[model samples]
Target chain A: MIQVENLTKKFGNVAAVDGVSFNVENREIVGFLGPNGAGKTTTMRVLTSYLAPTSGRAAVAGFDVVRNSLEARKRIGYLPESVPFYPEMRVREYLSFRAKLKAVPRKQRKQRLDEVMERCRVKDVEHKIIGHLSKGYRQRLGLAEAIIHNPPILILDEPTIGLDPAQIRQTRELIKELGQDKTVILSTHILPEVEMLCNRVIIIHQGKIAIMDTLNNLVKDQKIKLEITGNINDITETLKQLPGIKNISFTQQDLWYVVTIELSNNEDIRDIVYQKIVQNQWGIREFKTERTTLEEMFIRITTRE
Target chain B: MRNIWVLTKKELAIYFYSPLAYVIITAFLLLSGYFFYQFVAGIADATALRYVLEFIGFISLIISPMITMRLLAEEKKSGTLELLMTAPITETQVVVSKYISSLLFFIALIMPTVAYVILLIFWGKPDLGAIICGYLGLICLAGVFLSIGLFVSSFTSNQIVAVIITFVILLIGWVIGWAGEFFREQWWKDIFKYIGFFEHFDAFRKGLIDSRDFLYCFSLIIFFLFLTVRIVESRRWK
Candidate 1:
């Protein structure tokens, strides 16, 4: 339940987020994919009411971010890029304080603190001072602080940045669990994370939204890569006659020729292709379908003018 | 109001949990105690804290910046300002809570000096009216200096720079009254005398409850606190 229209935030002469527009529906896990300095964090800060947009409007839960900032901020749980914390405070003490600041009911404050600590996996370090916490623990603590109030909207900027691989997977699972009920907008440069976690992806480049679509639609072009030993002309002629084949290209890999066949639709034509290969008595080594990856699409979108 | 209290409690906890508050408070008490003993020994039978309170005011003028330097600056440097400002709290709440916590710690710093007042009462017939006024004057002076320090701290992320610049500003506010003596024009003299922070404390120090001095002290506090709030609010625009 967030709406942003023509949002542009300028820091002096340079615009960090220029003419960016996007909306996120309730319970939709949307990933913001962009390289560094691509206005992902700036967009998030504006939504969280941390930075006032220079021009245009953003509303959260039906409240304007600037005019009704308190109400708007009340619905948002933001985890900033760096995950800042007061180092002297013990982890449990800090979460309680954050819960109070977020206006969690006093009766539920303790329970909420424990719940977030467990969900974020910072319970083991709850008694230790934050300054002494490892980076992964501190990052999780930041996540705990964010959801302490159990806000309906979450704006996480690189929530998995500093975590180890196992921690990253855990955080992804946590975000996925949170996303089942909350509207989540997470930004990251990691393409695979978005592919695994997000239903919708928004790619921003140079302070502008390059593309926004469902993950499936963005990577819809599928191709079959086949490694076979046969007469190159005969293999190409046989693949061209297939019903769903859109295009074919070949590359030589030593003695074997690698054939890339683009498909016209989302269909399994491997059985027919196998039959034709068997009838021709050609030796096939590799035959697998490959969807156009978000990584390749992300590079293409961000690197283009 | 609830948000203000929550933030104020957090701010107070930060002060006590760290060694900075203890070190500064102990140093202030030692310096004030040494000065009080010297003043009493020199006078043979000192009955009034007139000079002692004045010296203590000067010491607070120098010590106050240390208390407030990290209030806003450290938040900015450590990027915690993002967390603080994004919370569902107003700028007034944040600024008021920071001002109140530092004011409370400052009060704690001066509370032990009440023992000096008690000792005076025990040994000799001290002018209770002048001593009360002197202590009130110290509190009001602190309100002025601490507010200014909070205002200065809002401008920089560097704590050392915050302290130095705040010290310079408070020193100027303290000594600006001397400029009045150099001016031949009556208007120039009156302007300096009215604006000088120390000049307002003189009436309270002499046991006279002048409403003009009270108004001046309050107006300065309100002005600086208002400025600090505006500075915090301006952050979002940038």
Candidate 2:
């Protein structure tokens, strides 16, 4: 339940978030994928009303971020990239204070606090001073604070950053669980995390939305790889002549030829290439169609910078 | 109002949990007590209540910055300002809470000095009117210093820089009255004397509740608090 229309944030001469527009539907888990300084955090901050956009409008739950910031903030939970906390406060105390700041009713605060602590798996360290906890525990405490009010919208910037593998897995599972009923906009540089957790992905590069689509659609529409061991030069030219073939390159390793073909669109050109190979009487060691991974797509998009 | 109280409570809790608050109060109390004892013994007078009040005013010159140097600076350094600002609380709530908590701690530290007032009651009859006025003056002075310190703290993330800048500003405001005496022009002298902090405080110490003096201190406090809020708001852009 978030809408950003041409949102832009500028720091003097540099545009941190430039003319970016996107919508996150209710109960949808959308991943904001980008490299460092790709304006992901800036965009998230604008949506959360932490930083005022130099131009354009953003709204959460039908409230304009600038005009109705307090009401909008009341309906959304934000976990910044650093997840700053008062180190001296105990985990439960911090979460309770955050609950009060979020304007949870006095009567419901304790129950909401306990529920979020349990959901975030931070109940055990509830009494421990947040400063004394390890990084993973501190991150969980941050998450606990964000969800204490049970806000419908969650804007988490790099939610799984700096966690160990097990902690990452745990957090990923928790995010998936939370996404069941909450609208989550997760910004991170981790491509696989998006593929594993988000239903839709928005890849941002150089402060612009490069690609935004479902994982299945993004992979199905981009480049495809075919490994064929045959007359390398002849088959490469023939594959290039195929209707859907956009670009083809071949690298030889030992006795086999690995050919990577970029397609103009998602189409079945495998049979046509196979017939061409047979007509040319090329030696075929292996022939299989390969779809582009999200990682490959991300690298292609970001590296274009 | 609820948000303000919550933030105020959290700020005070932070002061108590950290060792810095204890260290600041202890150092201030010991130094002021030593100055009070010496000023009493040196003057060869039993009534040192006014002298004690003046000494406290000077002690606030140091203690005020110590209490407020880290107010917004540390929040910015630690990145916690993002958490506070992104919450439902408004910027005014944040500024007012921090200012109120600083004043509360300042009052708490000065509360123990009531023993001195009790001692005066036992040893000699200090003018009750002047004693009340003296305390009023100290509180107002602390308010002014705290506002300036909070403003300075909001300008930088460096606590040391905040402290130094606050101290310099307070020192200048404290001593600027002397500049009028150095000048030969009577109009310039009068203007400097009227603008100085000590001039406004002198009326309060004399058992005179002048509205102009009260308005001056109140305006200074409000002005600095407003600047602190504006500076904090501008940081989000940076």
Candidate 3:
């Protein structure tokens, strides 16, 4: 579990992470969404005990990240954004070193390294020097390093970046499997990755939590659009009077009226709209209800500023 | 404690694995050995090994900083420092582990110089006291340079800058004594000489075990290492 309270970190005069707080429950995969320089990495640094909060507190597994940093760090598996490594080291060698630093018992270090290597799909490059590996393998090796000690919490910063489509899918599947038993706080630019892997989304902008909720609740009420060709003025009036119609916008193209309707409280106005169109003797051309994807919602929330 | 050991092991591996370290080591061994052989070939000066050690001390003055320039700088450069710090270890452990590893590598480079002492024992009646004091002085002097080197490396990602700054700081300590030459006042001269590392090292070359010299080396080590911890901790705050 991870708890952040009023966490603020400053660089010189600028507050990189300003008054941010969030809680992650056990075994929950929380997507940390933010644009570039949005303080996502700064917050992750604070949570991992790499950076001390300038004016607030962060805890992992009930240990204070600053006061009890060593204990706090023991529970966190952090993969920083750069995914840096000692290029001279072999994949297996680096993982084993991390295993030791993470305090994996000496007896189990080899097994842990092997398991993480396999989980990250980097077993083939175990003995190969890390410098010689491709970007995808190096990124996977960073994952392998993070999970080597099998920490309960995983704080991954852009884990799937620079990977091929197939590699991305494999990493996503691996993270999904990891989230089954561990709390994962994944910060990434990929909207689909977050949509597929994260159950809860925390959209951050300018160092503040802009939107935080389940993936479903982010775009809660789905809207419907109906295009009618006959007696569009009457149809507009009828649609405006509908109980759940929160918004109705019309665009005219020649003889047809394109009605875009936004409903509130999960209202399904389609059947009633269809009935109205039939009852009023209005001809319906295109009637459609679409599910808004996370990309659309992401752009809406992040750009709202 | 074990974390320090683990980190030190990895650092030492890097030292041996990298070609630059080997290059530095070979240069160190060749230069120290050549000067040492010359000191022996010159004649039985009785203080031959001490002169060789003093000369090696000067060499270490130049090379020790290079050995530790990348200790923390490379980690910061590559961003692996985040991996190290976010592990279950304190900043103190990180600094100490790196200092110990660089100190060990310096000692390994000095290991061949021990053969010089063995040669002295075989070829001449060397004063064992001066020999032991010379080694003690070299190790302690190394502690001083390595600590400063480690401190400089902590806050910078540029290895060249780390090396240059470390050399500048150590060279200041080395040359601070020369400025005393211009002073007619014994107090000012004594002050400059006292701060310079050469004065304390000279005492050991004469087979003297002065606690003052030990304190100088120790305080310098503690002082730089302390500054390193503060710099490392300030990264989060900065």
Best prediction by DockQ: 1
What would the TM-score be for candidate 2 when compared with the true structure? 0.90
Best-to-worst ranking by TM-score = 1, 3, 2
* Model 1 stretches with alpha carbons more than 4 Å out: A252-255, A279-281, B44-47
For A206-229, candidate 3 gives per-residue lDDT tens digits of: 888888899978756777877778
lDDT (Cα, 0-100) at B47 in candidate 1: 43
Please report, as a residue range, the 10-residue window in candidate 2 chain A with the lowest summed lDDT: A221-230
Estimated TM-score per prediction? 0.97, 0.90, 0.94
Compose the digit string of candidate 1's lDDT tens values, residues A1-305.
99999999999999999999889999999999898999999999999998999999999989999999999999999999999999999999999888888999999988888889999999999999999999999999999999999999999999999889999999999999999999999998788999999999999998999999999888888999999998999999998999888999999988799999999887788899999999999999999989999999998987877
DockQ, every prediction: 0.89, 0.66, 0.82
State which docking tier applies to candidate 2.
medium
Better of 1 and 3 by lDDT: 1
- The local distance difference test score of each candidate is 0.92, 0.88, 0.89
Q: What does candidate 2's lDDT look like per residue over B122-205, in tens digits?
A: 877778888899899989989999999999999899999999999999999999988999889999998998778998787777
What tens digits encode model 3's per-residue C-alpha lDDT throughout B1-238?
Answer: 9989999999999898889888998899999889988988885677888888889899999998899999999998888888888888888999999999999999998998889888888888999998899899999999999999999998889999999999999999988987898989999999999999999999998899999999999999999999999998888777
Candidate 2 lDDT, tens digit per residue, A1-305? 99989988899989988889999999999999988999999998888778999998999999998999999999888999998988999998999899889888999988988888888888999999998998998888888888888899999999998899999999999999999999999988787899899989999887889998988898785454555666677777777788987888778888787777778787887788778878888777777667778888899988974
Can you give the lDDT of residue B226 in candidate 2? Answer: 96
Best by lDDT: 1
Candidate 2 chain B — worst ten consecutive residues by lDDT sum? B40-49
Worst window of 10 by summed lDDT in candidate 1 chain A? A296-305
Fraction of reference contacts reproduced per prediction? 0.91, 0.81, 0.91
